[model samples]
Target: MQSSSKLFPVALISAELRGDLTEDVYLLKPNNSPDPSVELALTRLGRAGHDGARGVPVVLLHGSFANRRVWYTTGGQGLGAWLARAGFDVWLAEMRGHGLSPRNRLYRDNRVADYARYDLPAIAAFVGEQCAAPAHWLGHAQGGLVLAAALGGGYLAAAQLASLTLCGSQISRLHGVLELPPLIWAARLLLRRREQVVAGWVGPGEGYEEEPAGMVRENLRWFGRFGEGRQDWAAGLVEVTIPVLALAGAADRSAPPAACRQLLERFGSPLREYLCLGRAEGFAEDYGRAAMLLGGNAHNEVWPLLEYWLRHQRLPERR
Candidate 1:
């Protein structure tokens, strides 16, 4: 149940069979975090038949107000299961106080800064240690922003990563209404009154939890439409030279294609590539924020493209 290495402690909760795939969940405590009670939950999905051998490692991070279910479902579906079936070592990470991860002492006070500064690197290091190789990372929406913050702050080293993918993530989108203090207060009040949807595909009911107010405040600050300006992302982001892929949803009003493109353009990686998911780009339909990963056509159309990109570290071959 519980195990420890010299570095930190890793507790294996359970290993169950999800049809043809194996699911293993662990609670990882990183010693570097300011809060010792901060433990992250990671679910590993692997296929049968490969003795113990693992293919390339891939870590999937969900957006804010979401959890691991964003990339995986209990029925062994979603991108995480698909990657596992394809022989890649796939990890679904649940942020602190979300899903399988329990709340820390200062859970409500947590911010993206806390996640980027401590949590992400810890997860990456643990993955690398297990697979003995740098792992690829994919972030959706706010998850992508966390990745960018980690890289920009020099918290996650390039050597620790194989590649980076930001799906429908951008900081350039300005929400002018959030600038008003009264509106910000009202937003928090509303979030408390309603169920926060963690599973975007599940629609307005169930799979919900209340998000921390501190995180909401930090998110607003990042927009720079109010409060002080955001951190100087360029200094650290331009230093990131890892292979990068930035994907945008054509119909995603939350993060438009132009904003996504702007984020990708700031990266220093010479191998940077941009993709727009829409009919014009040969995709089945114009993807929205959540549809980019959960739409009906995603498995048949988008997943294959992701697999190819991860394997080749290049753009997928067009049909």
Candidate 2:
């Protein structure tokens, strides 16, 4: 399944070396959306002068309220860099209205449906076109949710997508006062009035990006419905047979371990695996949502597992 948008005006905006890694940034115009102003920014990482002749292509997607920087910080190495150095064609995607991707004409009106149904599939097609091979996908938090929706919604197909990896994303686990109908109504009302959710309003850190109220509201709707409005998210995922690896933070209150397990159970893929990080699971300490991908511990302990998983996927022949 291809994206509804047309691709054009693709450009490589910058290229620089970071500690033996070559980072190149590209901009892609889908040429169609509710808003014509939106464009996607993809960052490519590889060794200097290295061609695609010997590597599997991998796409790294960041969570909500974040940008492409989630994959790597300036002058610093992250998972994408590690994967590149490990011989994978790594592409980091910045979602619409986040990071290098500018807000579109209907920015506030955008929904996860738009992301799953249009943006990601389009980006995948573009990456495949450039690499001449299907791409392995790794998504964190909200990025994972969008990936699930895309595959389950039929906007993305196994033909062009080799495998999937999700970190800190789950469809259920909303509880207590957060699930009260009146509370949901009040939250939606408040979100509709606010232009955006500010950074630092979320976690106790420096990385969260500002997000449109519509995005928050749409998420709230899912939380309230406990599913994607009319679709059975669990059932949809059950139909997908791609290999999947779901990593969860044991101490993640945002998306608890049990909830993440629920997500894992819903996948019909016979090759699916779920790993929860915590001391009980043989790790030094329990990890939280952000810690799943960030921090020194993640780099030292978690990154290798991811590397091993990606290494198992062979590059697909160009169709």
lDDT of 2 at 292: 70
Q: Best-fitting candidate, measured by lDDT?
A: 1
> Global lDDT of each model?
0.82, 0.79
Spell out the clash pairs found in candidate 2: none
Runs in model 1 lying further than 4 Å from the true structure = 1-4, 175-208, 225-231
lDDT of 1 by residue, 110-224 (tens): 7888888899988987887788689999999888988998998888898998999999998876444565767766766655544332433223422345566567766655554
TM-score of 1: 0.89
In the order shown, what is each candidate's alpha-carbon RMSD?
3.4, 5.0
Residue pairs with backbone atoms closer than 3 Å in model 1 (clashes): none
Clashes of 2: 0
TM-scores for all predictions: 0.89, 0.90
Mark the regions of model 2 whose C-alpha exceeds 4 Å error after superposition.
1-7, 52-54, 175-177, 202-207, 224-229, 313-319
**In model 2, what is the error at residue 54, expressed in angstroms?**
5.2
